[model samples]
Target: MKRVLFLFLLIGFISKAQVKPTIQKDDIVRIETTLASDKMEGRQIFTTGVDSASAFIEKEFSKVGLTYYKGLKNYRQEFVVRNASANNVIGILPGKSKPNEYVVFSSHYDHLGKEENGKDKVYNGANDDASGTTAVIALANYFKELNNNERTIIFVCFTGEEEGGFGSKFFSESINPDDVIAMFNIEMIGTESKWHKNSAYITGFEKSNFGTILQNNLKGSKFRFYEDPYLEENLFYRSDNATLAAYGVPAHTISTSKMDSEPNYHQLSDEVSTLDFDNMTEIIKAIAISSESIVNGKDTPTRVQKIR
Candidate 1:
């Protein structure tokens, strides 16, 4: 009977192992372009454009058959930004076994709005964050299809990353920090890194062993995750991952943007035309594959040192 159980588990593992990148470039392009389109008006917070972006993301979650986050009636995790209202679009896939443990996949969707000038009023922000949001959505779809995670997966597209990390701050406070096993915060991966294609850098890499575990998983793949090269820029605490990292979660930002020279960084030319969809698709797949063991509860990374 024990032998039969071992064989059963081995077969299941092989089946999961053999699964390739199911998320295609076409699907990624469609999602990225739509989010970065001029029609979305740069997805600024507390505006109609950002509202539309959230709706589109919620629709995708619905299509993936994801459940609402805990204590929410829908996918929108709403909160007040002073007098105005803003929200984070969140969805969850409950674990098959370790339901209490959580693995978070996050990216901020907010970006600069239209400027006063008629010359390219839309910032587009295709690479700044629309690409990252697209990745989160794609990962959600891929993991949902697998349906074997032992850790509950939370996919969130944060708001107000440009103004501040208000969305992530609220989210971190809403849940117990101890319950969160890891946080994969993807940002600005539309372009290839300085190391070139199929490569990314993780911020706060040395603070925890998260990057090492991820690298260990991609033993045979061409893709690579490197330590953040622009340490002087202090990227580890810049994005939505900051708040969670402060609480001692193994939260890290995965990015390819070159801080010293990204030509389109916050410029009017940050559009889909500048991105490499094929490479972006590969980055998303690498994230999905590298994170599988953690989701399956086979690996646990060291926690970040609590700053707060």
Candidate 2:
């Protein structure tokens, strides 16, 4: 009788293990459309554009069925930045087992507000950060559908990253920091990489073991993970992840920006029409795949030790 029950449990485990993970094409399209849409006014911090973007993100999170942060009624984690009130859109997918241990995925949704030349002032920051924001939204959809994570997953869409990283800073201060185990901040992944095709780099690669673990997970996949070639760019400590990493978490920024030669980067021509959808799709999938182990509590990357 005992042997019969054991065999039944074993069969159930095998069946679950065979399930294949997938990302939706519609979700990808939504990302591009949301980023390219003119209603966002480039998602500038403290502006109506940012407010509209936040509403859109909250709606997406609601559709995914992700819960709000504890004790909060809505998805917005409101806070003040430099005397101006802003917020970080927050949602959580509670873990099946370890609810306290968290893995955070973040992207700053705010961008350069407007440009000088009156008529040419609308800065459609498609690649600067809209791409990253899209990636975060898409990732939330993918994971929520799977609904099998062992560690809690927190999706944060931050504001004020362009001004001074205030949104992330405010969030980092509000949290215990110890509950967070890892953080992956997606940034500007709309273009092809330099060295490896269909590959992306992790900023501050040498600071922690997270990058190495991510690469190992992608061994059989078409995408590859590489250390950022533009280390002099100081990208690691420049993004939203820097705040959490300072607290000794395994936090890093994932990006595909060619710092030295991105012709449209931060320019008027930085539009959705210029993005490579194929590469962007692959990048999102790669991130979803690489993070599976971490989300499942199977592989916990080492905590980052700050240089300064």
Point to the candidate with the largest lDDT.
1
Worst 10 residues of 2 by lDDT: 18-27
lDDT of 1 by residue, 1-308 (tens): 99999999999999868464398999999999999999899899999999999999999999999999999999999999878999999999999999999999999999998998887899899998999999999999999988889999999999999998999999999999999999999999999899999999999999999999999999999999999999999999999999999999999999999999999999999999999999999999999999999999999999999998
Scored by lDDT, model 2 comes in at 0.87
lDDT of 1: 0.95
Candidate 2 residue spans exceeding 4 A from truth: 1-21, 116-119, 306-308
Which has the greatest TM-score? 1
Q: How well is each residue in 1-308 modelled by candidate 2, as lDDT tens digits?
A: 99999999999999878456577656776776786567788788999998988999999889888899876899999987668889999999999899999999999998887765676676788887888888888888889878789999999989999999989998898887778989999998888888646899999889889999899999988889999999888988899999999988889999999999999887777888888888888899999989999999999998888543
TM, every model: 0.94, 0.91
Total backbone collisions for each predicted model: 0, 0
